[model samples]
Target: MITFYDFICPPPQATKSGNTWKTRLSLNYKGLPYKTEIIEYAEIAQLYKKNGIPPAIVFPNGYAHHTLPVIKDDITGHDVFVVDSLEIAKYLDKTYPDSPRLIPDVEDVDAQIQEFQNQLNGAVIAALPVMFKASVPHISENSQAFYKAARVRDLNFIFPDKPISSLDDLQFTPEEIHATWASLEQGFDGLSERFGGKNTFRWALGDHITYADLILAGLLLCVKAVHGEDSPQWQGFMTWSDGKWKTFLDNLGPYLSEDN
Candidate 1:
């Protein structure tokens, strides 16, 4: 049996992280059976050493590593570690070829498909500073360093600045909140133009649902959660243009809904 180490913040129930969401999607798609070990960020040190993080697979040997879509083959006693969401999707396709394929094999079809996946993953992660900084008071230094290094665009980019820290304090006045909201709005707008417009795309690249759809659907919930339902920040960008995700989820729905 595979043991998955899971984090409980950002309210996992409310909005599962890209890593967790990707794992669940793949597991569900593959009919994999696994167990979960849930822990708060502050307790990660005590839970499974300081390096523990959800999406990580704990082997029978008790070793834990940062991996997403991790799989432990109890039958063979083999522990597989997969990091990136796209990589996980591809791994699933190769490992379980009979499962529903997320990305088609044709090179021409795939090139376009990958573009949208990049936009969804890259654009949403462009604001990693905001999320990581907010998690500072709760997580360990190793986790902070991991996120800072992972998110650095260039050598000089120092994240967790005083201004960014201020937002975490949650003491902002209306003006400050508006300013912060404006910046987030602009950021999402840039992402929308690059990934969500009519010509921007349905799946990040073409019309079919691929890794991009899973990424977009997950990130959309995060964005919607941040910008209140009443806020005009992403009013127009809230819904997928063609209702693809809605149709896919149908009764279940991809988003967390405005009421959440």
Candidate 2:
């Protein structure tokens, strides 16, 4: 069995991180048997270091950030640790060639799909202020402190026009919220056009599903998880781009199971 590492969010929110969801959805799609090991946000770095797992990301300032969606696979009769969602997906595809490939063997296909995922991620980041605000109430105090500090530290880059020193700065004005939503909508529209426009295809690569489609679904799931299905934000999102995203997610229902 594979050991999947994921973040532990409090009640009312299930599997909050899109990065983790990418791996989770990939595992489910490939019919892999795995057990989840939930870790708190504050414990990530320590846990990784204690286990001698290398950092998943190293920032320009030399900060080694250890992230989740990590996996320990022993099916090949050798223990191997894979970090990062994309890497995990590629690893799974290479290890279990008999399963449906998430990262196809076609030439340059993986690069193209990664670019598509990057575009979708831009939209998700644009809507972070609102999503993060909604999530604050549901996370633990330790996570709240950790996230707040990290956001505040990176405020200049994310919100250069409105520098902030605290999480209270996220109390966005009505105009600010409207502007962010507009940016997110525009981002979605651009992505939709790239894949033959809204309602044109069931998946990113026509009839077949790939990591690209999973990338889109994971980000959409993040919004639903944070805003709740009944929230106005989520309700409005379901109708955006001619209901393209909603239909896409619905088609992926079989692979969206929460159970491992």
Candidate 3:
């Protein structure tokens, strides 16, 4: 059995973080028997270090220090840990040879998926904070401060040219919010080009759900979780994206985890 780590949000088990969701997508797709261990935002770095999960060779955005979606299991007769969502997905596939792979055995798909994910992550820089602001209700009161500061640091500031030294200095006015969402809309539009078209295929690459699909699905889940799927903001976002995000969910239905 594998123990997956995630962030515990409000409403208890209602929301899951994207970093963790990506790993969950792979684990669920592989049909692995795993349970989640939710961590609070403020203790992320300490908990990750306690588990002997080393810091990433190159730091990634959206993580306070150590990223989640880590897994602990006894596959090799002794317990072992794997951290980072992509690395964890690869680890699971290698360790469990019989399971369906997130990355297929096709030529150039790996590189292409990697490139797609990198672009998506970069694009998220625009709207992630806007979504995060709307989703603050789910974060624990004590952890909110840490979460905000970390986001500010990761985003460089709530708005460019305005310096933000801490959570207190952060600003998210209506104009800034609109600009952020505009960035998100543009980001998705750029990514949609790679698909050839909405009618091209259900998945990002081809017919099968590859890592690229899981990566996008994880991000969608994160946004949905934060903004409350039923909230006006989420609805507005769906409208802004021209239903592309909803279509993504519809296609990903088959591969998603049961609870998800």
Clashes of each: 2, 0, 0
TM-scores of all models?
0.57, 0.90, 0.85
Please identify model 1 stretches exceeding 4 Å from their true place: 1-3, 10-16, 30-33, 40-69, 75-77, 108-114, 121-127, 131-201, 224-260
Across 1-260, the per-residue lDDT of candidate 3 in tens digits comes to 79887777777566557777788878888888888777788777787678676765444544436667678998778879887887887888888989988878879876887788788877786566566666567778888887777667666644666556754554589888878877877887777756555545457777777778888888788777776779776787676445666777777776676463
- Cα error, residue 144 of model 1, in Å, equals 9.2
How far out, in Å, is residue 123 in model 1? 4.4
Which is the better candidate, 2 or 3, if ranked by lDDT? Answer: 2
lDDT by residue (tens digit), candidate 2, 1-260: 89998888888549888889999999999998899988888888887888788888788889887778789988879778899888898999998888889987788986788677777777667677676676676667768887676666555567799777777766778888888888887888777765567558556866688888888888889878887889888898888888777777888899998886
Best by TM-score: 2
What ordering of candidates by TM-score runs from best to worst? Answer: 2, 3, 1
lDDT of 3 at 166: 58
Which should have the higher TM-score, number 1 or number 2?
2
Candidate 2: regions farther than 4 A off = 153-163
Q: Model 1, residue 42: what's the lDDT?
A: 42
lDDT tens digits, residue span 31-113, model 1: 55557655554454454333333534454656454433343334346665445566667777787777677767767766665
